[model samples]
Target chain A: MPLPAKAFQRWLHGIAPDTSMADVCRLSQVKRTTLAQQLVRGKVAEATVVSISRAFNVSPVTSLAYFEVYRDLAGPLVPPTRQELVSQIATVDLLRAVIARTAPEEGGGGAEESTARPAESWELSPVPHATSVKNWVDAIDDGELRHRVSAATGIAPQNYSAQLTANRLAPEVAIATSRAAGVGLAGGLVATGLITEAEAGWAAGARRAALDGLSDGELTALAGDRLQTLGKALRRQEHDQEQTEKIWENLG
Target chain B: MIEILQWTTLVACAAATLSRIPNLVRKKNRSLFYIFALMTVATLLSIKAPYLAIDGMLGNTNVANLLLRFIIFGAIYFLGMRIAKGFGDVHGLQFIRGRAGTVVLGLISLALLILFALMDSEGSSVGMMDVYAKDERNRLLVEYYGAAGRAYPAYVCLAILPAMLRAAGSTLPAMLRISALLLAVGGIAITLSLLFPVIPPALGYLTFIINYTAILCFVFGLMLIWLAKAMARRKVPEHIRKPAGT
Candidate 1:
């Protein structure tokens, strides 16, 4: 995925063929010896590429996109993935969820809280839930879809769980999940926020309407599942932050 | 060749110490400044010309060599304490500054003084061990002194190695991680240097090479951390200023 030494040379020639390496180093602020060593090794370092981008009047991201691994970053308007959406939920919203779960009930056996409200603006968007990718995958799954998707994608169960926690699925894994669930092939892409529901050919308001149409029990179960995972993640994060704080206090 | 390496190492240690003078004068991180200063003096005293010159001023008895050993102990102690506290390594800190650490350091210092006193008082010489090796009884006393001088540093280095390795793998700044790695290498080199006397005479060429290389690594490692701090205080230079992007 890295731009090879030859390709980097080609790029340099394309930009300013007449310039000497010394001049390039002067402009880019890269060390001449380091650049020469990298060239000798048939690779160009990322820092060298970044410095070259500045010298050549190109954005670092645009220059970085020349590498295959960074091609996804070159797109003008790539949407945030489902994991990003889940991670971006407001603190107040998270607190509300926690409070709702533990609040005293006026009457015994009351209906779930989610069924009491209509779909809100954030929920009715083309990309629907603020919940993690894991919860969405679990909700759409029939009994064996997760296992089948994992087998097809060649991602181990633990790795799959980790990806879900991060709210991400590889594009192929997303497609495999949809295939295993017997849904539209692009459903996984839409669920992962790789593509909008509109791009996936969903009718206006259909995605929101589908979410609104789920039964109270199903909604409650999904909410419970998402909150449980989120609580564990939050606690682990808090513990780690405490340790980092101690290190900083002693050293920094 | 050994003399050349020793002088080269002294120059480098001097440079590293000199580079930190601004910080030292401002009373910032005085412990680090002291570490570099002590190490510089130790390096100076280890070299032949400076050792002979200074020993002549101090009553012509090679006590400068003993002073060099004590300075080395001070340098290693400060370096170990800094690494242990910076990494929040409780075990390393306890082993270094705790009761057991004090006892070990005291014992080593006592042993070094006793061995030096027992050796026949002689005219000044830079390489005391090499000079005393001509006489069997003085050779034994010098050998014991050398072992005593190395014992505390080896102990401190052993205690700090785990902390250094952990810091190398941690999410600290890149320069700090690299410094930790260099310190670990220096510690291992020092340990190997201690064992060099046990190796066959044919492999003796490695003695000064390993010793000097360990000194250079330690100096460069500390210098890197100092440079990183200095750079962090400065604004990005205009020449490499990143172009605004979409």
Candidate 2:
């Protein structure tokens, strides 16, 4: 869509709300140079617009229409309601729970060589799906699949998969993966329509652990809701990333 | 199983023939390396086949089996040096570095191959004409040799991986290094499994799975490399922006 005026104001106002223009830029899935050019030219791919809008929680149309968001104009929003706060706190607590299992104890020691040689010790953990996940993550990291991830997440058309697959979308790929995956976003951010299944699963697992005390009904309902939300966010992020990649491809 | 062997033979011939195509079409020495690489890969490809296990059905040893066995051992040495040089050169290798480096590498690679070959030798069909001499000691010796058979590659990788990583410019190289590391570890695990084989052989079979661990390491390592490549392309920009953002 041609960048709309209301979309622009909403986009401008979107990012400045939480953090700054710089943060918005940082959060943008597109490279900084490309984003800057998009600002200068008043043109950006739909995917970049999606990412930029999502980053600042702006309306996508406004994000495309407007050039930038400044932090000074942003204001503090109210805290979440009680129910929302409880879910978020539980999610954070879930993340913290993982630390107990992986980290070393005081004085820094782990099991030394046992009677058995530590042969292929890495695989002893035997995660059935880790192989596939690791492979996907690796492929994605290769930057050969950013747009692919976007497409898979349903953010853009499958045809758009080529932009990232061709190795064109460079710079802040971590952000692309993180944003596209919605690695750190709360359940709400996950709900925004741009998170991948793998990412959502990880979030769900972490969230589940933290909210361990929740009733079965609450947990089940929350899981379904969170999963749905995460799927949407992953799709959105993928689409945004796809758009940013297109901008780069056109420039290239 | 026979199909796999046949497929392998077809691939080997194809690879050997394909190896020549590069040298023939371009009419360049560069093709010589490609030929060697394709041939080497073909050889590596063959070493991984079990029929090339002999001494037993697809298990019976043949000329191709013996040929592949020797070729694989010999080629591992040539393959490492060649592949190392290939990767090194593409990433801007200067000299052979030194004659000493070649000698040292050749020795190490040769030793490992020889070690693996020697271990394989334990499976020899050669029986003493004087049957009385072959006793329990013979049996024990065979068992011990079998125990350490798979461990050799694991140890070799462990020894070499750090050095390889140090020489690499990118995560991909380091990851290749990790593959070597996994080979060492995986082999050791397999060896351990063989040596202390659980009585039922069920647990023992589980240990054989260690060989695949090297494959897993390579899999994950490959992922890291892709990430690094992607990151490296943008690293300069990321560096530039990090300070400003901070």
Candidate 3:
């Protein structure tokens, strides 16, 4: 399932039905003038590549690979068929179902953790305990949890723990954690080849919601498939920009 | 005054430079590590004079040189790739190879060249050796760029453009990116103030306040990351790094 270049673009384009380049530009660190020149030239040249490279904290080689992936809509190579996309969707759904079932929260096992609570905290790696950090945080409704997390992850804003306590987990915090753990989870199921950018986006959105302090319903609202996919693209753009800035800092 | 900091910085530089090579040379998908290697070298080179002489050491010039050569160039490289995707939603630029074909690359080179020229300019130079010699805290770049429009590229690259990107979207994710970018810009401003000094910067007191605050946070973050990695590698005694894990 090696992602062909076209599939990558299709997937990139596919995230959030009709994601605009303007959105990407807003998310990326590349200057508007530089972006203009590239548009006029019709291809990312050395300058763009270098800019992207510096921007993302990656080398030109990696940037070029991404360039090929993102180069226009037609895709540099054969893309997945419609059926393939559908199948990917179906697979994701199946996993979600299994996750829901095991977690005891989604469909059948609602309120399974109503009577239970961890003594302090524990990170479960192997168990399918039918509960998510979001659910746990939501149920507990405490900022101490955010403090605990901050103590663990080294992010800030004093009341993050309080927000977790207050059932007000910040969206950004959720997204960051989700990115860290969600990608790992998805990698377990779908190989990079079989997964389209859209699916990846969804997983990211889901994870962001989980970390974000939003209730499941709220997450679902924000992450309705198309919007979630778009969010993913925007997130990727943001990540790219952060990476670019880091690259520049290193250079500076 | 700077002797202790200089030596400490040099040692850290040497350690960073040496720690990265094995990973860099390894043939198996060596990118993240390679970037680190080059970055260390660049940092070391930029700060090399600090290790040797207090007086003749590269001050603000090195910082500007590194920014144009490293940071700005890297941004252009990746932006090129994304723009290559020809679509209506974006500018839909075609991808071209070679230095001559890439206008952005041309501009970056030109910027660096101009920066070097600026470095040689009368105001850009070391006009007050005595003042710096007295305290070494009086940096020049900050004094210059902090003014209305001196560090034009730095502002655009470091501050204004990122702000615009942030404005284009109002998502929480955008907020985080904007925050990080803002802090980085602040970092640049402080570093400029410290190393590549401008004669008169914008609210030196304010700049000092923000710079130190942001930098302390950055350093603390770095320390924590290092500590976490050390603990993961069992370099940190289990008893101290993670009492809970026990």
Candidate 4:
């Protein structure tokens, strides 16, 4: 939902008490004219809010909660499921761990300790597509959960599949899936990289704890599966690019 | 029936042209403005009443027909160049800009002018076929001239049809995809009409339907693209449009 002008102004004042509008625009990486237009319209856009939140190093969900529209989604949440926790690991981090497992130790390797230990906080970045929507859905799916969520949300199977492939879940679909799985309602949002775990009330190091808790065999299998999917995705992208190139070559 | 179809298509073309008046006034995409304006005028001149009036002013020697031909040529040339570049089709752009394409267009235009000059020009008519039907020599020249007029557009359309069809089925925005589909179908219809002589004579009525529908579809397709772009400039995403008063 659009943030109200007054609420936005209040949030801006709180975030940067002495900062000028030009500074705000620069910090948010939003154009001055665009910000002015939104202010004049009496509602700021959601992306602008996210940009401002990122600029100030605050969780987007927490920033959004300052507006009345997102207040309910910001605060505390129930503990996340094991699947939800694992889903929070950034894709590159997961891949890095997999690669690190095989790499020769520099001096008297601590490979065993490395495999058993939790990830460092810096390695747990939450970029979009870190875990695809499909993976998150699958993580929560206890066989019948997907069918139940589909029925409850009234999202067609094909449409759901398309959304999964696109790596996006509509907010409603995300909420419904989380509800069906009986996990924290914010799990879907967190897993999808739409909101941070801090804002969702997940304890610090929870994701690392879950990753460390996994058996070496489970971790290897998961990494292998992800790598296979990544390979297939890269191939598909190559094919599409080739097709586009051919069209340009022959027709342009 | 043909007259009704022609009028309907003409009106659609005019509407498409008029829809871009705001863009023209704002000095946005002036090339597109000229292209649509030229196309609209060409469509208007295709009508009997306007053609007769304009032709009368031009000495009633069928100079208006030649003017209409040249306007259509200019419009199509600009359109082909713009669309090829817009689609980022380097090959299509190169072909149109390269010597081969330029020579083909030049030859066709020259052939059309020479054929028109050779034909009987005592009276004005909407079509060369209609006025020169009685003059055996002029009839042949008119046919060649018409064929020459159709050649360049068909060639360009053939080159762009594949890209347009692919775009129609792509993941582009809904309006753009629809526009691509309409434009592709219009291009196909136009190509078919241009090749009508090779088709069975019994399908003459089909040709008329395709011809008029193609004009309407092509113009409306361009209009939709313009409308979509204009709307996109001002549009706030659905999630961002909550009531401000609240």
Q: Candidate 2, residue B24: CA error in Å?
A: 7.8
| Model 4 residue B99 lDDT score | 85
Candidate 4 Cα outliers beyond 4 Å, as residue runs: A1-133, A136-163, A167-210, A213-252, B199-202, B236-246
Per-residue lDDT value at A250 in model 3:
30
Clash-forming residue pairs, model 1 = A83-A167
Residue B64: error of model 1 in Å? 1.2
TM-score of every candidate relative to the true structure: 0.61, 0.31, 0.30, 0.58
Error of 2 at A3 (Å): 17
Worst 10 residues of 4 chain A by lDDT: A243-252
Docking class for candidate 4: incorrect
lDDT of 3 by residue, B1-246 (tens): 333443444455445435545545654223333433443443343343532232234454334333424542343233222212211112213322333336544554565455444433222222233233333234343233223122332322332333324432433233333443443444355446444343355544554344334333323322333333344456443322100112
Docking class of 2: incorrect
Return the candidate ranking by lDDT, descending. 4, 1, 2, 3
Model 4 reaches what TM-score against the true structure? 0.58
How would you encode candidate 1's per-residue C-alpha lDDT over B1-246 as one tens digit per residue?
A: 887888888888888778767767876667777787888898888777888899989987778878988999999988888777866778999999999999999999999999889887467786585547669998888877887888888898889889888878754667777877998899888877678658787987787787788788888877776666566558563322111111
Q: Write the per-residue lDDT of candidate 2 for residues B1-246, one digit (tens) a residue.
A: 434443554454455445445446765434334434444443343343533343343333232333443443343333333333433333212222245445544554455445444333322242211221346654454444333333333333433444445434222334444533543343344334444534465564343245334333333332343344455457563312111111
- For every candidate in turn, the CA RMSD to the true structure comes to 10.3, 22.0, 26.2, 11.1
* lDDT string, candidate 1, A1-252, tens digits: 235798889878877699999999999999999999999999786558767877888765456556654454355533333323332232234334444444554222234334333542133323534443565576566678768987887889878877876678765576567567655555555556654555444555453343344445644554565556657766665654454434333322
lDDT tens digits, residues B124-202, model 4?
8887446568678877788787778888878777777887887788766677778878888888887876876666868
Please compute DockQ, using alpha carbons, for every candidate against the native two-chain complex. Answer: 0.08, 0.01, 0.02, 0.05
